[model samples]
Structure formats: C-alpha cells, structure tokens
Target: MKKRFLGYPNWWGEMPMAVYTFIEKHDWEGRTIVPFCTHEGSGLSGTERRIQSACTGAKVLKGLAVRGSAAQHEQESVRKSVSSWLEKLHL
Candidate 1:
C-alpha cells in the first residue's frame, strides 16, 4: 500500500463530524472501506459497522485499533501490528 495510514488524534466515541459528513456525501456503493483508529481505551468503538451501515453497499474490512498509549510509547510494537494487519488485508 503506497498510502496506508489513517490516524485519529482523538476518540470521543465517534468519528469526527467531517468524516461522517464525507461518508454521507460520497458515493460508497460497492466500494471497500478499511477502518483504522487510534484510541486510548475504547478500541474501534464499532466504527466498522457504522461505516458499513452509512455506506450502504460498501464492504467494510476488519479494522485496526492501536492504542494511543502504545503509539506514543511503544511505536515499534504498533508498527509491527499495523504491518501485520495490512498484510492480512492483502493491502
């Protein structure tokens, strides 16, 4: 994957309004969406399902949830996990 990173600086139980708005306005039918998020504790907070529902016909792949703590202090570990996740996704 040439451009594969999606980072969320904060997680207050949902995606930023801009992201949802983008999803609402875009044509996602039959497209594939991969969700990745950084969280302190809540993990992905069901974003995969939310994206799938909002996108109608889109295929939502299994998401990656990297803890903000790990990303800040255990970056190498987070990198390995992210790499493994993308490999599994065939990206």
Candidate 2:
C-alpha cells in the first residue's frame, strides 16, 4: 500500500476548479455569501469577485481581510462585522 493524501494537498493550485464547482453548487441558494480571508498581506485578493461570479443568486458581501497572525486579536472585529452585515442583510 502507498500513502496518499485524501484531500487536496495543493489547494491553491486547484482553486480555479474548486471555485467553479462551488459557484455551480451555490448559485441558486437565496442567501448572501460573505467571505473572510486571512492573508499575510494580500487581503481578500479578489476572492469576493470570484465568489460573486460563482454564486449567481446570492449577494456576495464585501469580505473581511485579516492578517493571519492578527486573527486572534481580531475576534471582536470579526464578530462585530458579521453581526452588522447580518443585520443589514436581515439574514
């Protein structure tokens, strides 16, 4: 027997196909899709746009960008933002 990685080992490399499938699957879901991305410096990196194109019927909200290192300290901000967005969207 050989050792094999069950999940995608190179997620970034497969992101395009993954995004396409995600978009196709969620296109008809009548809910807002909010993305929160943690990056070293690149921020959301246009992921919101990609998600918007993928999720046709859902309104993709402006995503939050938090430094991966700073995520622990950003708990309050994340909570507040999500709460505000949910309230605004009435979701």
Candidate 3:
C-alpha cells in the first residue's frame, strides 16, 4: 500500500480483501481507485465511500455493486451493467 504500484492507473474487480487492505494502508495521491463488489443481496456494503475516505487525494470513481448469482445465471445482464459502468466512468 505505501509502495506505489508504478505504472497502474486503476484497480478493478469485486473489492477483494487485499485491495481493502492496500487502500487502508496506502496513500493514493495521484491514482484512481474503483471499488466494485459482488454480494448475495447486500450490495457494496459502503466500501466505495469507505475507500474514498481512506485513499486521500485519490480519484475514486463511482463503484459497481452486483449480485453474485447474476454472473452465473444472467451473463448478458452482468455484461451490460459492467459496460455501462465502464462507460459512465469513462474508463
């Protein structure tokens, strides 16, 4: 976390514990962090806001929260959601 990731500009994937730990321990002065999460029904659990608060000076783009089951049973829907989110973030 304190160590820079160097060439990376952004982070993705369901907000894994490792990412949470990294954010908590790091100072993302010039980076952008996106925290997405998958759940049974509970959504992001506020990790996005928390991430923004934790990573000072970082550009924390809006996060994505999707249900875990959707990926297995509704692939196209998940694809659309991801596509839209990426577009909205201009990523």
lDDT for each candidate structure = 0.78, 0.55, 0.66
Report the C-alpha lDDT of model 3 over 1-91, residue by residue, as the tens digit: 1223211112242355666676677658988776566677667666667677778887776777777789789999999999998889776
Model 3, 3: alpha-carbon shift in Å? 16
The prediction achieving the highest lDDT against the true structure is: 1
Tell me which residue pairs clash in candidate 2: none
Clash pairs detected, candidate 1 = none
TM-score of each: 0.83, 0.55, 0.72
TM-score of 1: 0.83
Per residue, candidate 1 scores C-alpha lDDT tens digits across 69-89 of 898999999999999999999
Best by TM-score: 1
**Candidate 2 runs further than 4 Å off:** 1-23, 72-91
The better-scoring model by lDDT among 1 and 3 is 1
Error of 2 at 4 (Å): 33
